[model samples]
Target: MNLLLVVAAVLAYTVSAQQCSTPRVRSEWSQLTQEQKGLYVRAIAALAAKPASNQYANPDIMGWHDFVITHAREAYWAHGNAQFYPYHRAMMWQFEQAMIATGIWPSNMGVPYFDWPAMSQNWWTSDLFTEQYLGNMNSNDPDHCVLTGPFAKGKYQVAFDVDNRRAITSGDTTCLRRNAVQAAGDDATAIANSMNAGSFAQFTSSTSGSYYDTTNYHSTGHFIFGGEGGDMSNASVSPNDPIFWLHHGYVDKYWWRWQNQCEQFLYDYSGTLMSANDPNGNGIDAKASADQYTASWPFKVQQLLNTQGGDPLCYTYSKSAGDIPLAPLTCPPVVKPSVAPTTAPPATATGGAAATSASRQGSQLDDKWLYTALNLLVKQKPLGSWGNAPKTGATAAGGIQAADAGDVVVFGRRDLNETESFNGTLEVASATVQADETITGTIAATIQATATVMATTSAAVSEPIKKEQNAYIETINPDNSTTISYTLSNNTIEIPAGFTVYSVMPISATAINETSGKPKRFFPEIPKLEYVQHAEAPVNVEVGSHPCHLAYPILLPESYIESMGMNYNKYFNAHVRSKMQIDAFNADNCTTMFSPSSMMNFNSL
Candidate 1:
């Protein structure tokens, strides 16, 4: 009995130690009381007015601008990679502390999120655009400068344009600019797709999107809120906008929701530190860990993972309209779609141009295609031997290539700032075509390539193309929570349900936002692509179809990967491609460009 009492005392002490005394609740903008909202805004103004603290260490900057500079300096490390979530989580907590320091808000008052999807359909008409809230949309302004509201032009002086490094260092000042626009990527389906990811590596990749991919909710949210020429659009200096805190608060809440789904996910952190767009010459694509320090923040990544774990992060997100669990769906086996067989057309010499259709089957391509057609001519080898090309003339091994492909005109999807559709071109002087059977036995056709063929293709075909079926079906629940379902790995995922069902959905209603009573004039007129209409994943394994290709050297050999005690199949499958293509290439006797054995040259890649 004495021993039991001693053990009970220790347990009680542990429980007491772990309990948080002043846990805060981060709410949606609509959820905040009028007084709370006023205080929140006042705190922001007060914080902006205060001088930068010595701890922040930015010379001649306001307290608020210090956060902006911190974010800008560490932007490269914070975005397009695994550090995205944890780094922002830490930044959010620090911003909260700074706001609390203003004395206008209560010590435990947490940041509020703009539940973007909830009001996304009618964001322009929402109370968020009022002078009392974030600011006016300023849709009519040529420069997209905020014209009225608390953050309108001249209301607050921006320290510098983060886009220009010199401007940042020189501390150039300007009025806030917000070219607010809507994006298909910032919808309920996109949010659901990201939240449904079963693993952290998948979650991070899907949620953040790759450096080359900007269709995901994270990138879209920024683009929509940041508008065309706004502070929020710039990843590095996004903190310049006060709304950045709220946006990140929503992101943290999403992470928190993902964390609560399972015990394993709470501290689950694994992904490469190097993003696809590696800017810093970081040779090591190091695996990310919770133990690592967050970008620009003093806290460790693990500490930032937990919201109620105290000291730095001690807040709970108020349950809002779209709050839902990450449902672990077990889908039924997939029935492979039968490809209709087509007889090869007879080679005819009756026309000025040969009409041919080449289809690419997979996402990753072998790098051997980097060689010029002259190289193939010198070797007198069929183009199919080099890469996944056809064995014939203009019809063979010919299709649009990605902009990054050597010496070719860069086209298709580009970074947000890029305006040019065509960059340059590759000129192949003269090439003789060889076909199995031709009208004249061995037809010698002279081919001259000038412009990027990819440029002439439709946007859907030029950029990453998504099969029509993978799109999410969003059902608005009677309770206001969204039931978004999508297919991943043959598993049809309907969040909150234990089972799965296959679905092919049309794009969600784009007109829902327009139905609101707001006059048409109130909305922003900024033009942008509808990513919702073109969400991408695994590519169709049609030769000459896709532009994005992974060089062979990047893939670790199956034997070597297995030797390290990792699943080689999982590593390969982890790439954003369909399982069918990955499976086909992994098999022996496959005669595709993705020859794993021949391509595995780690020694001299």
Candidate 2:
């Protein structure tokens, strides 16, 4: 009886010690006491000090901030994809575990979140960012390093840019940096509207900031804190920042608000499962596999859907939207028709002089672009090699340009950006042709190319939220050159869901805002080609009715990509396409590029 009584007392004491006093009301920065704040900072710094666990010390693993980037990087999933909410929620939870293990976080404490709107006007001046606190902004540092934050000043050393693979440890031993620049798409009105969005896609897109839809808070935080060399902006080391947890605490609140606020979407859940490291590669996985997409966590996505029921239901935060007001519930539902119209084509015809066909009318290529005519020269054959055309006096433009003695011209030149049809039907009516007798031979020719023009636009356009379907075709030609491309079949930018225009605004005296909605010029003029429309068949002198040679060009353009500084061929499928293209490639299995109800963020942060 005496031993039993003693055991009961110990059990009671242990329970009392571990009672998580409150659910996650993660206090705002101003509410935390000096000790609480310092503990949080030091705890994260302590975790940063330890080498990654041997199990996770792989070269691809970077910093204490591994799981999120790992899934987003190696698994090639998460972020803007439909898994945005659940995946990040789990990521934050995992991060909290690390802090707990560090023995610095107060027992049973909650991670705090920053109220951007409340501090928007004077965020930088707050003591939360002083040399004694999180640290001053990196603006004063010439090397673009964060040297004043509490975690800076030798208080901690952490990894940076681990997503770059080769950078797992390269130059990682440095202070974090912050640019204090306003991330674009963070307007108050936009924020409120996004909060009011009806679907998961809409909500995720808005939060995607300028990179996806029309939201701001989440995006604004990333760029503002991670400008230049700041870890926040760098997806690889974003978690290294002490502020990362607090910032994401608010982001998690956004999800909870969408669900419980008036319970508008209490049981709502709808989105496609995309591939990423899943053995199946890139498509909808079987239910067993799909349910397990919580990155490297022990739990699944469904467990994260309900804050009140998840294993232990650890914490919660204030639902009051604070200074960044919640958007009105009246905002429109997110939708994308398979076919949305683009701008009309230019009227004046030049180059290959493509007849102005009304069927090809859609989005307009920027008029400022020097519309260089596109020329497709196919290698025709007398069995194995080209031997020039029939030398027949064929009429092309001013004069028929002769193919080098061993080549055959299929489609003549024209401004691909302006004249290339979105339908992709550059066809030749007949394969039979009467070329100079010497070049007589039948050849089955299929030359398909999809060209999408991505550039720094005239207006800062923000449409990164829509996760598009995969639109690509990869086929080897006899010449050994591989043609991999993203065909822009139904890539239409509908207003609201597919369009955004904004100008940068001043958030604070020290904060230099860089709004993406504002106009900015892009490089490489024409980044790459995206699509081809089905229309009038291509026309050129058909070679002899022979089927000796098979040739086609997909033209994703590796040369141009390198010239523009994009590591195009990082891997067989290391996606270097536009933000949407990359997302589409990972989501869909190289099929039609249409629309997905969920979000596939490009990690634009």
Candidate 3:
């Protein structure tokens, strides 16, 4: 079945097709004029009154809303993994096409996208929810159903979670339920991180994870708005929410922004190629492309990849600037240390948060003076391994004894403060120097600035930056350039040979000063893996949610076989191919779709 859709799409976008230039701009709901909003409502009403295609079991589609419900039913396979962006883009376009077909939509009007990230704080409560628009939260119904909306109870009866559930093999109708959830999931820093991610792999790795934090962009919106059992929470039926279209608009906009960053991003396709095995022997199984995606219109992943092409999806975003907050990174220049004035050489840059204090007794102090040349990697000062230490330095830190006992302090011949000149005792430390109060609340603000910038909603560093236990505190060098610390083990940690523990990198003074120079939003990057603490519990969405007749997926009518005078079972592949071509060939009336014998719903004659 997937191949059928791909073939249709390949034929639809012939080489001669015009590249979209005067593309319509999709804007926020609040930004729309009264006329536009009214057209949407009217179009919706017309679609509702139109007969439900009966492609699936529910014959009571009340109008265009059923298309939205049909999409909600298929929500299971729409998200998670990679095709999420492309799959949904195709789906929304189909929904728009349905509205347009009903003649309710204005010629220039495209589906409006809600710019959640771009809105001022507490956007859900905005005027976009007015009775003239999508309506407000229900005061009488505990499910938070919408009241006073055009689709209100008598105005429009819902059949599933909102209007229905995924499996609608029987009778089930309900009112539209909505709880406008205040989403603070993606803050400026996190969204900025996602937008600036270096590669698609990096972007995918970071965004699709299970970690629901303040930085997540796509899924977090669902979790934030879709409170327990709310229609938006369940992927199988999230489409029940009217605002779903708008939210996906923002998502599609993000893809557009990322794609326009560079031409190479146009072909950047990762994740799975084929979505599921075709239930229809005709080989029409769903692909990551468009078929079951939204009416399964002949749109492939590549066609939607770039919105500029005139191929069916020819819309553009009015505002390319993502609502994401910008957080800039600045790495300062490195400064070399001057030699010691006294006989003692510069103290080695020690390891742990707070390095051990200078030795008090002369013999122990002499032993401390013994040091070995440090091994350096391109980025880190590798304090992991060490060799024989030879006696070198003589001078000792002038600081008094009785340092914090519980704390590990590194005392050397001399340490250098940002202000103080080097060659003497410097109180240098690793994470703890920055960890005492830098808890989970502060973790998102401090991801490593230098690592591969994958925009992950990684569940890794989900835990707050509380005090890490059983970590290593090494006092390796005497130079104050930088210090390295490691996470040794947990309470049950058993150190294995050759196992490199997690490293803690302290920021350099120059870098710190450079970050502090401007607006003073200092984000020092930590270990990349350190951010991903765990894996999210995977939820595999079912292929087909409910029973259907036509087997056209979302495209064909039930009587396609008898009315077209063909044995659908005998030449299923050929029949499907012809139907696809016929649908595109005749954009209006969808005549070939409706078989006179198959038409049973009262809405359609």
lDDT (0 to 1) per candidate: 0.44, 0.38, 0.38
TM-score, one value per model? 0.49, 0.49, 0.46
Candidate 1 lDDT by residue in tens digits, 1-605:
13332222222212211345567888898888899988998888888777544223111122787687656545544664577788778677767766765668786567888776544344456677778877876556655666777777667766443324222222335566676664222333225445555667766643221221122345546666776566776665577777788778888887888777665676677775532112111212345666555644445566666677653357788888655333454332333323233232233322111110000000111121112111212312111101222223332222221222111111212212222232221111112222431222111111211112212221223233222222343343333222434433222222221111111122111111111111000111212222221123333333223322211112234443322222233334432222322332223223433233322321111
Give per-candidate clash totals: 12, 51, 61
**Residue 76: error of model 3 in Å?**
2.7
**lDDT value, residue 145 of candidate 2:** 61
lDDT string, candidate 2, 1-605, tens digits: 13332222222212211233355556777778998888887876676766653222111112364543344233223443455667677667656655665767764666777765443333555676787677766656554566666566455665433333213223545656565553222322223334555765555542211122113355457656666556676554566666777778878877776765444353444443332212112212311222343544333454566565433245766543353334346433433223222243334332121211111111133211111101111223311111112222221101122322222112211211211111111111121223332221121111111111111211243442221224323322233222222253312111121111110111000000122111111111123334332133222212222121101111223432331112232211212122223223233322321112111221211
Tens digits of per-residue lDDT for model 3, 1-605: 13322222222222234546677678767777989888877776666667544222111122454555445433322433345677677667666656665656764667788766543234567566778766774335555556677866457655333212322223334556565455333322224345454544455542221111112355546544554445555554566666667778877777777666666666565442212111111112211222222222233455566676664457777763344323332322332223222133334424221111111000011111111001000122111101112212220111112221111111111011111111111211111112322223223222231111111111133332222223323222222222223343221212111111222212100111111111001112222221211132112212222121111111122232222212223223322332332233223222322332222121121
Runs of candidate 1 exceeding 4 Å displacement: 1-22, 57-62, 139-142, 162-172, 182-185, 206-215, 275-285, 324-326, 329-605
lDDT of 3 at 147: 63
Looking at model 2, report the run of 10 residues with the lowest lDDT sum: 503-512
Stretches of candidate 3 exceeding 4 Å from the true structure: 1-16, 54-66, 69-73, 159-172, 183-185, 206-215, 273-297, 320-605
Point out the worst 10-residue segment of candidate 3 by lDDT.
356-365
Q: Which wins on TM-score, candidate 1 or candidate 2?
A: 1
- Evaluated against the true structure, the overall lDDT of model 3 is 0.38
lDDT at residue 600 of model 2 (Cα atoms): 20
